[model samples]
Structures are given as structure tokens and as C-alpha cells.
Target: MLDSDYTQRFLFDDTDVRGEWVGLERSYAEVLAKHSYPEPVAQLLGELLAAAALLVGTLKFDGLMVLQARSTGAVPLLMVECSSDREVRGIARYDESLLAPGATLSELMPDGVLAMTIDPTNGQRYQGIVALDGVTLADSLSNYFASSEQLPTRFWLAADGRRACGMLLQQLPADRIRDSEEREASWQHLRTLADTLSAEELLGLDTQTVLHRLYHEEQVRLFEPRSIVFRCSCSRERSANAVISLGQQDAEQLLAEQGGAITIDCQFCNHSYRFDAADIAQLFAGAGTEGPSGTRH
Candidate 1:
């Protein structure tokens, strides 16, 4: 049986080109279940999630990778977060009334900026910014890697309403192939094979079949697959901390204004956390020992 929601890493045994394959089924459905997003926004979000997983798999990191885009068009914001552990979540901000039925990505996000942020657990955070210049998300990312990174990288991303999938192939630093011409040839050869993969095959086939179909002539070593999970890191404790950060005066004032429990809803998961007067009292009673603030800088 094929792994449906797992990300697998593979290396061309004879060359410096490495690739990653990610398929999101249950994880995709879980993200869609959190909100009733329009088709275009949903599709873009799925592609972002898939790309994030693929990048995290390619990079060596211990924390999180964020793919974010900001626009002044119909869709204002698209964000996807993938942890080193393959946990992924995504969200998109859009105006349904402004969307045309067949609006292209450029129309949806005109003059947008795409950014990739790698936040490590023990090191400094790094971010790469580029223009959203391509028709698809994959194009922009591939450009980022090729130009900003100065590395030959290619990305094939696909997402339907039901499934999100992606593959990434990147040429590593000079190792086995030291000659410039040989490295270029190898990179082009691998990319040529990868370009033959269609969106349908990517979304429909399993990892092994996909790899074999693409690189059967080459020596490839497949790594153990890592499962992708849909998870919101929000918790009641965090929500309560947020409430506490508002200070007692404002907290009580809001409670008075509402005439009932103060509800804090998580935008990512749409889960509401309510705190009543008594609950607020208990929270403050414990806040002295916890800290005066709970905000992250």
C-alpha cells in the first residue's frame, strides 16, 4: 500500500540532485474543514501547504518554515506553516465579492510579495522575499531558489479540491560532479524528466510509482516517509494568556461590556475560548506566579 499523507525524501545515488515528494489527503481535508474557503483561495492555500512540506523536507532545520504572501488584490493574504515534524496548517484571506470566476493568480494577488521564513529552534530566523511573478505558486518558489539561492531548483505543485501534492528537485553544491558542465547537464536531465509529470499523475499516483515513472533510469535511494499532520498549535492556556495580557482593567471592562463570558476565537481553527468573571479571577490569582506578560517578541 502507498503512503497517502507522508513526505518522502529521495536522493539520486550517482548525482548531487536530491528530491522530495509530499502527498496530502487527510491533512488537506482537515485544513479545509476549519473554514469555508472559496475554490481559488482554497486551491492556492493547498499549494502553499504542499510547497511548505516539500521545503521543510529539503532543508535541515529544527523548527518551522513559513510560506507567506501578501497582496493588494482580491486575495490579500495567503499563509502556510510547516514544522520540521511535517505538521502543516494554512489559511487564506480573500474577498469573495471581488473574485471573478476565472481570475488568474496575478489578478487575485496583484503586485504581491512572496516570503519564505525559516525559524530555527536554536538559531537565528532567516527570511527570503521575492515577487509573486509567476502564474502558479510553484513558479515563484522555483524562481526564488534559482535566483535568490543561486541553486538549480525546480518545483511541481498540484492541488485539487480533494488532494494537495508536490515534488521538489534541487541541485546540491558541487560534490560528486565537480565540473561545471557536467553539473549543469545532470541538473537539466533530472529537471527534464520531472517536467514530464502532469498534475493528474502527481495528485493520483503513489510515491513509488511517481518516482519510478520519473527516474527509473537513475539510481535513487528513498528515505523513510514522514507523516504530515494537520494541527493547530492554539491552546486554552495560550488563549488565557492572551486574555491575561490585556490586563485586569481591560479584561474586566470587556467582560462588563459583554455582560457575559468573554470569548476569544482562534482564527486558524475557529475554536472559541470563553472566560467568565470567576474564571478571570482564577487566572489572575495564578498569573502572579506565571508572569506579568505572556506575549512573544
Candidate 2:
């Protein structure tokens, strides 16, 4: 995987809605390394990662956006989180014994919901869920946009061994007197061109080149790119704070049973952090001296 990749936000001057295209290579590789996932599961995650970035980048929201799938099948759950800064992390839960070699989402996950959560840094969190309504990740996402946003949207996602990429086209909201029929005609033409895109082209072609191939007749404005990277918000201090939150008695008992300190492992990145007896003691002592402090370690 490469270090950090870029997500480009683009707008059609005549269309009401904005869109984004993101290609992830190294970031996706880092996320896939968190666990041993089957090929289907890995591919699902790559598409989900690209989709999550697309949604976040398109909205231009200063919040955390999450894409999650939960089901009562072999692949029970999968989720990816992306912040406005383009930091990303994800994980999947599955029945290893039941994993098929190349199960599709319909085969492995079956009935499920694709959920999106937007947690604004200063405001409330909003969530929207859509039925597993389409054949692939991109179609499901387009269905979500139609249902939730009432906007005509399209997604094209593709991944090979080396990189994963996705492109989105959306019809923005328009004014009453803007000749809606003309806009619709343009949209129809653009959509037809977009349909010509193949998986190989999506993953292999450069961003500008792809756009040119699809929308050569349209007036498109490409925004400044935002860099995306694999970033896990896990650390020893966070783990220690979690232990402290368990209360001194419970924490100490677990430590004693385990023979020493408490060990915490992050599910997203598989990073482990351990706190020794001294660390625990210091934590409780500080909490006592600081007068019921709500501070994190």
C-alpha cells in the first residue's frame, strides 16, 4: 500500500449535487491487514472503504461518517469509519468456520442493511439505513441516495490486487426556473456515458482522464484533493483510561486473575496495549487526588 492517497471532490456547474472519486491502495492494504479476511470479505471491505470516503467527501461535513453492515449470516458485521480529515479505519466480524472461498455479499451476508452515521463534532449524530437493495456495493449505495437524499445518484466501484477506486455522479437540487428538462437531458447523457465505464478503467485510469472520458461535453469543476490515510485512534493511554473506567476493584481483580497488568486490544487495528500494576495504581491514586476527575489518561 502507498502511504496516503487523495480523494477528489468534483462538481458539475449545471448540476445541483456534488460528487467525488476516490482511489485507495495503501490505506486499504493497511486496513485489510488488521485481520485475516477471505477474498470476498476483503473485497467487500475495499468497496465499503471507498464508498465511505465518497460519502464523507461529497457532504463536506466536519464530522465522523460511518458505513456499516449488520446481518445474521456468516459475515455478521462489517464497518468503516471516516472523519472529515480523511482518516479511516474499519473491521469485520465473521464466522471463520463458515467462510466460503468467494462468497458474494448476497451469499455471505444475505439480508442486511447498509447504514450510514454522521456524527457532527458539535451537534447530534444522524443515522440512515437502507435495505440490501442491489446486486453490488455501488448499486446499494445509489439506492441509499435515492431513498435517503431523494437525489439521483450513481456509483462505480472497482478493485484489483493493487488498488481500489470508486466514482460517483449525482444530480444536484435545482431551482424552479432553471429549465429542468434541459438539465434532465444532460443528466441522461452523462449517465449513459458513465455506464460505459468498466471496472478496469475505474481502477486503472487517472482521475482527470476518467472524467474526460465520461463527461467531455460537460462543465466540471474539480476541487482541491483531500489526502486519505489509515489512521486508528487507539493508544496505551486510551486503553489505560478504559481500564480505569472499569473501577479500581474490578480492574485490580482482572489484573490479579491474569497474573499481572490488564491487556487491551483494539479491534480496528489489532494494536494491543497493556497496563501494569503500577500504572493501575497511579491511575486510581490520581483520580482520588484530583477529586473525581473525568479526565482520560
Candidate 3:
């Protein structure tokens, strides 16, 4: 059986190629449990979650990577975020009435733009956008890497609502001493081998078994696997800071309209935070000196 909720990185011993495999199980279940999403939405979110985890594994940074799609079709918005620490969270906004059985990617998000953002812990943010022109999320992401990063990348992603899994292969820059034609041929050979991978195999096989099945003849090095978990970064302090950023006048007005207390609910984790009049007073009083003092539920 596949080892779920983990990402493993691998490399080719003789080629400038690297790959990553991500399998999501417990983390996927945790995200789905927070909301009663429809079948189509849940499946799409699962795929995105897998993609985000795979992408994060490729980068060597201490930060967060977000994959988001915005559209006007049955599903208006889908987003998934994975931090360097391996915490994952995702949410989808859609119209259930329009979602039918076996809805395709275009049917769920027609005329959409897919954006990937990388926010580092101590550096400027970078974002890449591509049109959602493919039938699958994998296709669009492949296009993004080709255009934005100028890298030859391929992805195979699958999700069954219960388990989400994906594989990514990237051809790194060739060495100056290496023959250009030889490197090109090697890249094509590996890509062709990866192309033979089926969604069923990706979702069903463990990392070791899958790699051996695909590249038994080649020298492939597998790294230690990293665990992925469901975690929400939302807290009452952040919510309080958001409220304080609204300024004292507007904050008080919102509190008055809400019957002397304002509640903030995290869309990703369904965590609720409540701040009463006294809490608001303390927030404004210690605005610059301290953090929010609201209660979390």
C-alpha cells in the first residue's frame, strides 16, 4: 500500500532530472471533514492539494506556496496552500446546483486563470499566472512551469476524494561539459518513461514500488520521505489584528451592528473567534504594544 500523507524526492543518477511524489490521505480527510463539499469540488480540491504539496517539495525555501483558480463557472474559486513545514490547507467555493455528476475541469471552471504564488519568510513574493486552458489541472501547471520558469516539467495528478496523489518530473539545466544533444535525448527518454505512468498506478503504488516499476533499469536515488499534515495558521491574534487594522471607529461600528461583539470565522479551518466590547477596548488600547486578546472557539 502507498504510504499516504508524505512527499518523497528522487533523482536520476546520470541525468539532470529530479522528481517528487506526494500522497495525501489523513491530511486530505482532515480538510474535507471541515466542510460538506460536493463531489466535484472535493475531488478538484484534493488534486490541487496534492499539486501544492508536490510543488512545495521542489522548492528549497522556508515559506508558503499557494495554487489558486478563479472563474465564473460552477466553481468560482479553488485554492490550496502548502507551507515549507509540510502543513497543508485548501478551500473551494462553488455552486452545488450547477455541479453535476462527472463534471469536467472546464465545466467546473471555464474561462479561469490559474495563479501560483511563492511567499518566502524573509524575502519578496513571486507569482506566476497562466490561463486554465487544459482539461486537467496538471496540464495547466505544466504550461505554467514551461512559460514562467523556462523548465521542461511534467505532472500527473489524481484524486479519488479519499486519497490524493501526484508525481512531478523536471529537467534541470544541463552541464556545460555535457553534450547538448545527449542531454536532450536523455530528457526526452525520461519524459517518455514518465508519460507511461497511469493515474491508477500513481494513486495505488507506494513510492518505492512506483519508482522501481518505472525506472528499474535506470539508477534512481530516493530520499527520505517527509510527512504532510493538516494545519491552520489562523489564530485569534491574527483575527484581532485584522480588526484593529480596520481602525477604532469602524471596529466599534461593526461591534455595535453585531450586538456589541464581532466574530471572525476562518474560512479554511472553520475556527471562530469572538471579541466583545471589553476585548475590543483592550485591543485598541494595546494596539501597538501587544496582540489581540479575543477568545477563540
Candidate 4:
């Protein structure tokens, strides 16, 4: 119950393969609540959110991991950001009238490109880009790993309007099974079992049950599960700084155009930050005069 939104990792004991499972319920609902998204858009966002979480689980960093896709089809853009703390938020842009029932991923995102960005707080940022040419997002991610890092990775992602779930299985460096043919056999065997996993089972079953169902005869080592929550990193102070970036003349003109105050809204959270005249003055104040009295709604 308490672990409704979490990620669990496992190692196929004595093998070079590891896997992760991510399920989102409340966090998905919270992202859905921020704006009114069509069914297809909502479903895509959910999958992206789950995918971001799944990828971030294997990474060791002290910053943000972002998955962004830009397409030439109905869905022009979709993005999901997950922090090292396991917080995730996502948004999708789409033309509802252009969407059709049972549209394939390629149809929804023709000629699209997916970018994975890892922005470390203390180090340089790294980004990997892949073409979204597969039947699903999972396929595109697998392609990314294949082309970019040459790591053998596979992903299974599913998202309804209500919840999102995903699984990740990757082949690590040869440790237990060194023979190339043996490794290939092991990977195929594991993937064969994983292929039997349905989206419904992934969404409904617990980690232990899911693992048992897939790897009934394998030696698996389960790790501690981590919690995932929905969080937007928007702040009134950042909003105020945005106003300051507009410069004195433009900021004043815009304030005047907006009836003596300017309102900045965060697209991710839809939170409004209102800055009045004195607040503006405080923002453009030279040196460390004082902070603005901006209010958030």
C-alpha cells in the first residue's frame, strides 16, 4: 500500500542481466490533474514518466534525468523529468483532433527524435538522442542503448489514462557467464520469459509476484525498492528572477501593459507567481538590496 509508487530492482543471480520495475499511481494522477489532456496524450505522458523513472533507477547521479521527444506528427512534443530523489513530472503537447483511436506510436510521432539528458548537479551534463521509429517508446529506448552505449538493454512500458508501469532489463558486463554463446543464450532465455509478461500483469502484480511469474526457475536477487513521487521544481524566487531577466525597460513596459503587475506561470505545475510594482522594484534593485514579496497561487 505504502509502496504504490515505487521502483524495485533485481539481479538474475549469477548472470550478467539485471532488471527494474517501476509503477506509478498517485504520481500519475497528480500529473494528470495539472492539465486537461486527451486520452492519447495522457497515456503517452504516463509511459514517458514511467520510462524516465525506469532509466533513472540504474543511473548514479546527483541531478535530473530528462526524457524529451519532439515529433512531426500530431504530438509535437512530450517530456518527462525525473530527479535523483525519484520525483517525476511530465507534460505532453498534442492536437486532439489529429489523434485517432489505435494510432501507432509512429503515427503519433512520425519522424520524432527522443533525447535522454542527464544533468548532474556537480558535473557535466550528458545527452543521448535516438530516433523514435519503433512501434513503441520501449523500442526506441532499446535502439538508443544499442546505438549509443552498445549496452544490451530492453524496455517494456505501458500506460493507461489512470496509471503507468514499466520494466527494464539490461545485460551487464560478463561476470558469471563469460562465454559469448552462453551469454547470448542467457539473454535470450531471460528475454523469452520477459516476453510473456503482459501489460495487465505488470500493472496489477506486486514486485515479488511479477518476478516470480517471470523468473520462476531462475536465481534472482531483489534489491530494496525506492519511492517515486510527483514533484515540480518551480519556485516563486525563480519566477521573480525571470522577471528580472526581462531587463528594466521591457519589464516596466510589460508590467504597465499588464496593469502594473506581471504574472509568471510555470508550465509544468500551472502555479502562478504574481509580481507587483514594489516587487518589481525589489527585483531590479542593485546588489543584495532585498528579496521580492512575490506571491504564488
Top-TM-score structure, candidate number: 4
Residue 197, candidate 2: C-alpha displacement in angstroms:
1.2
Give the Å shift of residue 211 in candidate 1: 1.8
> Model 2 Cα displacement at 123 (Å)?
0.7
**Runs in model 3 lying further than 4 Å from the true structure:** 1-3, 287-297
How displaced is residue 165 in candidate 3, in Å? 0.5
Candidates in order, TM-scores: namely: 0.92, 0.89, 0.94, 0.96
For candidate 4, the 10 contiguous residues with the lowest summed lDDT are 286-295
Candidates' lDDT values, in order? 0.88, 0.81, 0.89, 0.89
Candidate 4 backbone collisions, by pair: none
Whose lDDT is higher: candidate 2's or candidate 4's?
4
* Poorest stretch of ten by lDDT in candidate 3: 287-296
Across 1-297, the per-residue lDDT of candidate 3 in tens digits comes to 335699999999888999999999999999999999988888889999999999888898999999999999999999999999999999999998899898789888999999999999989999989998788989888888888866788888998889999999988887531888888899888888888999899888889998998899989999999999999898877888898899999999999999988999999988888888888888899844243444555
Off by over 4 Å in 4: 286-296
Candidate 2 structure quality by residue, lDDT tens digits, 1-297 = 223477888887766656688999889999888788877777788888888888777775787999999877888898999999889998888887877776767777778888989998888899999987578888888889889865788988886646778988888767522687887887777778888999999888878899898888878898777789999988766777788899999999999998886778789987767676777788888742222222232
Per-residue alpha-carbon lDDT of model 1 for 23-111, expressed as tens digits?
A: 99999998899899999888899999999999888888899899999999999999999899888888889999999987888999999
Name the better of 2 and 4 by TM-score.
Answer: 4
